[model samples]
Target: MNWVVFAIFAYIFLALQKGFGSLISLPEAFGGMAPSLLLIFGVYICLSARAYLALWAMLALGILTDLITTTNPSATIIGPASLGYLLAGFTIIQMRGLVFKESVFTLAILTFSAGVFAGLTTICFFKMRSFSWLTNDPIEGWDSATQMYRYFMMVLYTTVLSFPIGALLYRLSPLFRFHEKKSY
Candidate 1:
């Protein structure tokens, strides 16, 4: 894997996720869905790359995501997003061999599943931290039911958006292909 190329892609993804993601949002009633472009990109990279490459990239991206999105004034904790992405990466790596990576159906399923897992893992991390020794207060407005509903909506939205994005990525696979070419 080319580190320079991967870094450029990661920066572009972060910019998109931060700049364009906020512009597109659903109503509050429907959980105000905001698409996770980085997560989707991570899914694509995981499916297309080797295990080691995918793991490191996902970890770095996840940490960067947490740093960019952190708004809490009380604590400086930043493991939720990282942990979530790591779990998602691992899940995709484990299941990569079983599914057709180029299939839109497979991408959709994997994206949705990974989104849900990331969301739940994030929630769990926050919840755990809230009860830890360092914190005396719980996360504000922490409603499990509402959070789960919002996560579900976000997962659905991400899944729907993944189709077109996945198609484009699939078409461009040759550029980022990890296998070595052999001359006959």
Candidate 2:
């Protein structure tokens, strides 16, 4: 996988995720969850890239996520999302051989599954941080149940959006150059 291409896509996806979040978000009555474009792209990377490349991509995506989603600008903690993406990427790499990576449906399913894993891991990291001696809270709301529900809803929304997006991305797979390095 080409790091330059990966970085370009990462920037574009992150921009879309943040720039279009309000437009892409569900109604307030429905938990107001926004589809995570980054997660979908990250899933694509994990499914297509070789194991080592996938790990690095996931880490980069995670760090990007951490940087952007920081609630408090004064104190930025960057490990939660980074670790979450790494773990999710690792899990997907382990199971990639069992899935049909080229299928859009497979991409949607894996996106949701990985989204759930990474999202929950991120929440847990923040929750643990809240309990620590840190002066500032990492996350705004400490309501675990509500946060979990919202996160799940966001993942579901992202999964729904992944079908068309994944198809397009898969069509552009050659440009990404992942086919040559794909793990058999």
Candidate 3:
């Protein structure tokens, strides 16, 4: 994988996600779930990249996710998301061979599954941290059930959005140079 190209794409996608996410998200009444562009990109990488490369790429995406997202307005934690993403990426890498990598449906399903896994893992991390004695805030008083509901909703939204986005990424896959090493 070309790290430079991946970095460029990551910056662009993360910017769009941060700048325009709220505009595309569901209303607050429905938990305000938004499709995650970065997650879609990570899904693409997971499907197409080698195991070693995909792990690192997913970690970068996870770290970026941690930087952009916060359960609390004033506090931003990092380790949960990175670990969650790494775990999700590992799972996907292990399972990638069972499906057709080129299918948009595969992308959607994997994205949803991975999203659920990663989201739940992140929630668990936050919940665990909240129980620690040193922390004062507790995820803005949101119960775990509520968080899981909202996260599941967000993953569904992201799955729905992944069709078009995944198709586009498939079209652009050559630029990622994932197949270059296999050509000869």
lDDT of each: 0.82, 0.86, 0.89
* TM per candidate: 0.89, 0.90, 0.93
Q: Encode model 2's per-residue lDDT on 1-184: one tens digit a residue.
A: 8778888989999999889988989998777878888889999999999899899999999998888775465676899889999999998998899999889998999998899889889888877766757644445655777778888898889999999999999988888887564468
Question: Best to worst by lDDT, what's the order?
Answer: 3, 2, 1
Give the local distance difference test score of model 2: 0.86
Candidate 2 clashing pairs, residues 3+ apart or interchain: none
**lDDT tens digits, residues 148-179, model 3?**
88888889999999999999999998889996
Q: Report the Cα lDDT for residue 90, model 3.
A: 92
Candidate 2 residue runs with Cα over 4 Å from true position: 132-140, 179-184
- Total clashing pairs for each candidate: 0, 0, 0
RMSD of each: 2.7, 3.0, 2.1
Residues 21-96, candidate 1, lDDT per residue (tens digit)? 7677667888886878788788988988889889988888889878876536665567888989999999999999
* Candidate 1: regions farther than 4 A off: 71-76, 132-134, 181-184
For model 3, what is the error of residue 50's alpha carbon versus the real structure, in angstroms, after optimal superposition? 0.6
